[model samples]
Target: MFKTKWFSGGFSGGFSGKLSGKLSGKLSGKLSGKLSGAALAGLLTAAGAAQAASVSFVQPTDGATVSNPVHVVFALDGMKVAPAGTMMDGTGHHHLLVDGKPLAKGEVIPANDKSLHFGKGQTETDLTLPPGDHTLTLQFGDGAHRSYGPELSKTITVHVK
Candidate 1:
């Protein structure tokens, strides 16, 4: 079973830092795999994306076509960018979730081919992808690399030509 403390009318308060890894693990796995698109949208709407700090892509607008070595610029609002291990409130680093969806709240982002970590607090990068359509998710993580959840994330799709 999954445990969730959403941000609005349906959830509880005090999702402390201690609830991270465990809460995310339980919730993300179930939500990502089981919920239909409409169901997830409803939950997200109730979760209130506007209430949290958000991460976004400043370049490569959604549905735009571009060449390889795509330049990806990251933008964060309502927070500061700090290198990994800082462990400060309202501060974190940028992670580009290539060809993937936003991770669960407080989930420790995995290191893999698709998930690129900028522990150094970089705001931009040049990425190379094969010719095709790809979904890029801008995700924010705390100093410990635990995600700030879907409310803090932004997803955009682009095509590589």
Candidate 2:
């Protein structure tokens, strides 16, 4: 039987299994029922924090003026870029959040015109933006498209001429 003691907004017992490292408190017991949403969230957060990673723009220096069809390049450190659906530790693909804010932790990064997905492990891309000022955020997401949070993201501002 799996026993879990619920403390104030945390677990204070023991659970045996893969969740041992994800939880805040100690876990000791046989695997049991499904984990609650909170537990799953905690696990995801812990997983995201396991590595120290960073993403940045390699081209179009910040605050630079550019023309249409802007060329964008992405750089990553402390992790490997892998295609989506490839679940490997210290690996993930890049996402270009064009003029958008960072996605919440464990949140699924949306796919749209602004939110570009590099599921194929692309390191760079070309974007066409209207004449104006825009922000480009480079975010890295896990194989499942779950965001690694802002800690793994880089934002830059550019002016289109």
lDDT of 2 by residue, 1-161 (tens): 11112112111111122334534343323223467533644454576533355778889899999986788878786666777898966678888887898887789999887888888777776787888899989888989999999998889999989
- Please state every model's RMSD to the true fold in angstroms: 15.6, 15.3
- Flag regions of model 1 displaced more than 4 Å: 1-51
lDDT of the structure predicted as candidate 2: 0.71
Stretches of model 2 off by over 4 angstroms after superposition = 1-51
User: What are the per-residue Cα lDDT tens digits for candidate 1 across 44-151?
Assistant: 445553234567778989998998778887777656787789886667888888888988988999988788888877787778788889999988898999999998
TM-scores, each model vs. reference: 0.68, 0.68
Clashing pairs in 1: none
Error of 1 at 131 (Å): 0.2
Clashes of each: 0, 4
